[model samples]
Target: MEETMSTRRRQFKADARQLLDRNFRFYLLLFLPIFIIMIVTAVPQWMNGAGVDNPGYNLLSLLSIISGLLTVGVSFVLIDLQRGVAELTEPVSKSFTIFNRGAYLWGAFALEIITSVFTILWSVLLLVPGIIKGLAYSQAIYIYRDYLDQGHKIGFLEAITLSRKMMDGHKWEYFVMQLSFIGWGIACVLIIPIIWVVPYMNQTMANFYVNLAAQEDESDEEPTVVSPVDDADQSTTESKPETPADGDEKTADNDDKTE
Candidate 1:
C-alpha cells in the first residue's frame, strides 16, 4: 500500500512537471491571440467612453463586458489545451509539431459557451449554486481531451456524467485542493508579465482529474474477492483435520483393550 501511494505521488509529480514545461508555451500560444483580439476590440472603446458627459459610458461598460467575456472564453481554450497536453506532447519534436489545435480550441469554446450560459442562469439563483455548477462542469476540458479527442463525439450529458462519476466521493477533496491554490491565484493577480495562475489553475485541476482517472482505472483493473460463507465456516475449514488411518488405529486399539 505504501509502495502504491509512493508510485502515485511520483506519477503526479511527473505529470505536473510535464504540464508546467509544456504549458509555458501552450498558454502563451493560447492567450496571445485572445489578448490581442481583446485589446484591439476593447481598449479604444473603453478610452473613448471615459468622457464625463457619457452618462451610461456605454463604450467603457461594453468594453469591460467584452473583456470579461473574452477572458472567460480564452480561459476555456487554455484549460482545454492543458487537458490535452499529455496527448499533445506525445508527438512533440523540433521538426514536427502537434495537431488538433483547431479542434481543441473550438470544442472547448463551444462547450464552455454552452455551459457558461447555464452557469449564468444558475448563478442567478444564488452565488453558491453558481460556484457548484462551475466546479461540476470543470472537467469539460478533461472530458474533451480523453474522450472527444479520440474521435468520439461525447456530448454535454456524457461529459457531466463522466465528471460526476469521477468526482463521486471526491468532490470535497477537489474543493479543498482548489482552495489550496487560492493564494497562488491571488499572487498572480498582483504580478505582471508573470501570469501563470490561469495555466497553473487549469493544469492543477487537470492533474487532479488525471489522478482520479488513474485511481478509477486501478480500481477497475483490480479484481475484488467475495466470500460466500461466514467467519465460522472459514475457521472450520482452516482447522486441523483428523486422518482416516489414525481414526481406524484408535478404534482397533480400543477393541483390543476391550477384548
Candidate 2:
C-alpha cells in the first residue's frame, strides 16, 4: 500500500511495538546512550540562547560531522535490527557501535561532509531551494545501502542524485512529517527521560525510507505479461496440420465417389 504521512508514522509505531515485544530493554538500550549524547550535544545550543544564536562555524561544523556520522550509524543499525539482518546488536551501546562498524562510520562522516557542504551552498543563495535540496539529499544514506546491495557503483553525487529522484514527489509529505515531530521533540527535551522520541523519529524516517524504497523497487520492476500468442495451448492449436497418408487418402477418394 502507498503510505501517507500519518500511515507511515503509524506503521513505524507498529514496527516499534513488535520490536519492543521481542526485547524492550534491548531496544531501549539501543537508543539510551545516543539519547544521552544528544542531550550532551544539546547543551551548547541551549546555552547559546536556546539555539537562536550561532556558536561559530568551527564548533558547529565539528558537531555537524559527528552528529551526521552518528545519525547515519544509528540509522544503519536500526534498519538492520528491524529486519533482524545484522550482527550489530552485540555491542548494545549505539555510540560504540557507530565507530565499531568501521568503514560504515567513516563513510557516513564522508557523506555527511559532502552533503552538508553542498546543501549549505545551495541554501546560501536561497532558503527555499536549500530546504528543498536538503530534503532531496536527505535520503542519500538510505539510498546508499540500496545502491550497494544492488551493485550500483555509488559515489557522492550519484547517491545525492538517486536520493533526489526518490524524493521527487514526496518532499512536502516528508517535510510535514518531520514538522509533526516538533512538539514531541520539545516535550522530550523538557522531560529528559522521554528519550523514546529520538528512536521513534529515527525509526519513522527509516520506515519512510523503506516505504520510498519499496515504491522505487516497484517502479523499477516490469510487470510480467502473458501474451495469448505465446501460450503453449494457443501455439499448438495454431500449428500446421500433418499431411494425410496415401492409403487413407485413397479410401477418402473412394468414399467420396460413392457418395
Candidate 3:
C-alpha cells in the first residue's frame, strides 16, 4: 500500500531513532564526511576574513568550484551510507572511502553544476521560482548516487532530468517536509546534538527517497479505481427470477376457486 506522506515521515523518524540507538558511532562515521567537507569549505572564507574590506574566499574560481563539488560528492556518499550500501558493519576506516570512488565523485561534481546554474537562472526571474526549482532539483543528488552505485555510466544532465520527473507534483510536499525539520535544525545549533541530528536527518532523507521510488513503481502499475456506476451496471447484468404479471395472477386465483 502507498502510505500518506505524514505516515511515511513518522516511519522515517522511527527508523532514524532505531539506527541511532543501535550504533551511534557507525552513524556518526557516515556523517563525518559531511562535517569535514563543511569545515573545509568554510576555511578559505574564514582565512579571507569576510568582515574585512576585501572580504571573500581568496581562491581561484576553479578551486572554489572544486571545493563545492567535493562537498557535493561527500554528500552523495553520505546518502549512500544511509541507504546501507557503504557497509555499516565495517570499521570506521572504511566509511570515508565511498565518496572517493571516481564515478560517484565526478558525477556529483557535474550534477551540482547543472542544478546550480538552472537554480540561479530561475532566481533571476523571482524568488518563488528559484525556491520551486531548488525543490525540483532536490532529488538529483540521490539519482546520481544511485546511478553510479549501480555500475552504470550516467550523464550529468540526465540525473537532473530524471529528478525533475520524479519530483513532479511533489515539490511543495518536499518543501513542507523540509520545513518540518526546522525545529531539529534549530536544536543542532547548540553544537553537541549536531552530530546525532546530522545522521538522523541523513537517514530520514534516504528513507524518503526509498518511499518516493516505491511510490513511482506503484504508479507505473496503474492501479484501477472502481466507480459506483460500474458496480450498478454489473449488478443489472446478473441473472434474476421473473415476477408473474398481474392478469396471470388473477386468472390463476379464479381457476383455483372453481376447482
Q: Compare the candidates by lDDT and give the number of the best one.
A: 2
Clashing residue pair totals per candidate (backbone < 3 A) = 0, 0, 0
Off by over 4 Å in 1: 1-31, 34-106, 120-125, 189-192, 221-259
**lDDT (tens digit, per residue) of candidate 1 on 84-183:** 5323332122111112365654555566776677567667886766656556666655565455434445555556545545555555555666676667
Q: Which ten residues in a row have the lowest lDDT in candidate 3?
A: 250-259
Q: Which candidate is the best by TM-score?
A: 2
lDDT for predicted candidate 1 compared with the true structure: 0.49
- Look at candidate 1 and give me any clashing residue pairs: none
The true-versus-predicted C-alpha distance at residue 162 of model 3, in Å, is: 0.9
Error of 1 at 4 (Å): 14
Q: Which of 1 and 3 is ahead in lDDT?
A: 3
Residue by residue across 1-259, what tens digits does model 2's lDDT show?
A: 2355567767766786565556556656776655556666667667786546665647655665666566677786666666555554553666455676555665566777777886687678867666777787788766665445433445656666667667877777778778978998788768744656777777767767766765664575321111111232332222211223433311112111110
Model 3, C-alpha of 126: deviation from truth (Å): 1.1
Model 2: residues >4 Å from true position, as ranges?
Answer: 1-3, 17-22, 42-64, 91-97, 100-102, 149-152, 190-192, 222-259
Global fold similarity of model 2 (TM-score): 0.68
| Worst-scoring 10-residue span by lDDT in model 1 | 223-232
Off by more than 4 A, model 3: 1-3, 36-56, 59-86, 91-99, 221-259
